[model samples]
Target: MTLTHTSTGVLEFESLRDLLRGYAGSPLGMGRIQHLAPSLDRDWIEQQQQLTNEIREFRRVGGRFEFAGLLDISKLVDEACIAGAALETTQIRDLIMVVDRAAEWREIVMTPPAAMKNWSAVPNISEGIADFTAFLREFRNKIQPDGTLEDRASPELARIRREIDKQKRTIQESLRGYLRRLAEGGTLQDELVTIRGERFVIPVKVEQKRRVPGVVHGSSSSGQTVFVEPIETIEQNNDLVRLLDEEQAEVHRILLEMTRRIGENAEAIRNAADVLAELELQFAKARFAEDYSCVPVSLSPARDAASGAD
Candidate 1:
């Protein structure tokens, strides 16, 4: 039922709403409480009462109902709802958790405990939920927890990364060897392998800079040494950068495909959400009633004051 801002304040409904909201398990559940109001619709009120009573009765008979890991996926789902939208690795990870949590909740609710009775009254929140088992398994296998795709994610990616590793090692070993030669000749400033302008280089004395035969990247603040990228390593550095770019492109491809699959299953997800939200809300109502010592009383017209119904 709708309530004007003025009327709600006068009736002190905010306190009651906050009390109920405290029992919600997640943002989505608390959102339902935010809109909670006194109702005049007899059918809606009775239906809500029946659901809460059902849960409370089951609990009193040694049954438990707790919704764990119920996140508000409305925004994340919206990001995925658009066609051709590629969710980032972290976003996709969060979305995957939704599948797992929803599945866990579904299994527990559908397969009630042996001692549980009158479970027919409990809503089937898992009804029409899509089977995401296969997709979930595939995603886990291809994506690492660090957000990088596994070598087996794609053959091309595997090949590119392997080559990238090889090129990096080659550049490092070559730079270190050159640094050692310079040190032996007394032509080195620090004899250290460092990065200069995104390429491997070694610190050399200004007087020996010509001996190193490379482009100057930068000089030390004191002007005692210069950082240079050895000419021989330029080609290798370029190759490594190219390979890294390729790896990034392949990773994007994988994430885009996963997002598309999520989009395809959006309908089933939305349906499950509707039922789960209602299921969670009812369970919260039952807990609130028990904690507050609330009891359901029948509502009917007063024989003496017919207009009191207003």
Candidate 2:
């Protein structure tokens, strides 16, 4: 229900609408009503068809529906999906129902009735209205077989994205700092700093320190180690090099622990995401339903003939 106008001078209407579509398309959103009703019987199917027709008719005229009713639309679609017999035949019908419902909601929002004007009218409702209009148009166009991401997104998803980005940046910067420390001879090593693209790390022996004069040529398990000169710096930077190795090892351990924790909490995180997503979608459905519920599909001529002529 909270809303903030963006610097672009656009209301969050499109964002809200996109969120509604997401809920309508999700398993939870679609499942709520049918799950509650406890019957996917033939009688239920007939009732849904009748409800669909009524919804269509309601749109044809200007009708105001409660927020609860908008969610019912998604429930109905989900019910139809569960109804089994000849349900495939009703696919187009169900889509048309949603489309008609969505259009009705769009029109209502575009020119909401006085009773529904919960907020002060924007001085330039056009900018806000236009933004919402474009969103719906694009949303309708993008309604595809795969089920759009719009149906599942919520402000929470946006927040999750922001948090992930922040964490990633923090990790990146910490690594860079770790590299810089290694470069300033912060470690007691005379080891040369090697740079390869953005990756920064100091190479150190995992085993005992060894010095070789007269260009020692050797190989490890990987079979590729050669020296052009004596390895005098290795002995000088030994302690510093060891310090860097310890730091890198600690960092690596922390990273591994974090990954493990994430894996352990994967289900919890996913559940939290689903709840937020559903809430967002619910808000969207309610908002759209409220907005379009009262729009008149057809206009009548002015009652005052003189006013009409003017």
Candidate 3:
């Protein structure tokens, strides 16, 4: 028998209508990503809400004066997604795009449902969209139209801002005190320090277990090693932790007190931020409108007597 292999080169011609029929077929039902979409959106929304609160609180606490420029909501969102914070609507679209482009392996390529379920899910474009949306809202309503603040409702704002400055200074001074105490105390006894920069604990090796005779200890995923000593050492370790925990509690108390203080004052921190944001917008608008003059400023046209005399 002659050796022959039949090549099925016949390209089957199915109707184009049939080929395109279920192209948009979804993993779930008519709602498609219904289950995953809301969950992702909620996560994004909650994170955004928390971040907004933190920013507002930071501003209320006088962090705005220290840092230049308002918080970029879009950037924050992008960072959150990159840091595996949450997903956005556009991100789902991107996922779908990738799936569509996979050509042959489209079905095999995992969807958002699978990707989110995985323990090691990474950040994606969804975060960026969420942030962008926030920026849009803030820019349009909270930040843009107000411009410079008039003296009308400023006394309350000014008082709160002054209080924030004072409170921030107190917090800084308190932190310094905590740091000084830690330096004096040496080795945290009761508390856990986040273990920063060098000075990491290591475990004893098996071969050298006799010379370096120690117990098997917990290790960080980054391969940084940890060791556990006797309870005697633990007490010493915990003292610093205890002090730090107390310090943290104190700090929390201080923050609460400061917030309360602001609350006590006529206007809240949000009102103060609104004033500042309005002022910023007004200043920018005024600067844009002002005509350049070498001799005199258009907005504030006062010339010093000494300079005029010269």
Models 1 onward score TM values of 0.77, 0.24, 0.28
Clashing residue pairs in all predictions, respectively, total: 0, 12, 15
RMSD of each: 4.1, 20.7, 28.5
Q: What lDDT does each candidate get?
A: 0.75, 0.37, 0.30
Candidate 1's TM-score: 0.77
Q: Give the CA lDDT, 0 to 100, for residue 73 in model 3.
A: 29
Model 1 clash pairs are none
Which ten-residue region of model 1 has the weakest summed lDDT? Answer: 117-126
Clash total of candidate 1: 0
Taking the tens digit of each residue's C-alpha lDDT, what string does model 3 give over 1-310?
2112232122222232233222213221112212112122445544433433333333333332211223212232233334223333233223222212222111221333332333121122112111122222221221112332222223443444455445445444443444455345442222233232211122322333233222334544644334333232334334444444544444344334322332332122223232233223322222222323212212334456888674
What lDDT tens digits, residue by residue, belong to model 2 across residues 205-246?
423224222223332364333222223333323334444455
lDDT of each residue in 1-310, candidate 1, tens digit only: 5667788788898898788788888766777677678766777777788878877876777776555556666677777889889998777775676676666656666676665544654544346455667767767667666766689877887988899889889999988887777788899888678876557778889888998887888999999999878888788878777887888898888888888887877776666665566767887888899998999979895366766678
For candidate 3, give the lDDT.
Answer: 0.30
Q: State the lDDT at 211 in candidate 1.
A: 89
Ranking by TM-score: 1, 3, 2
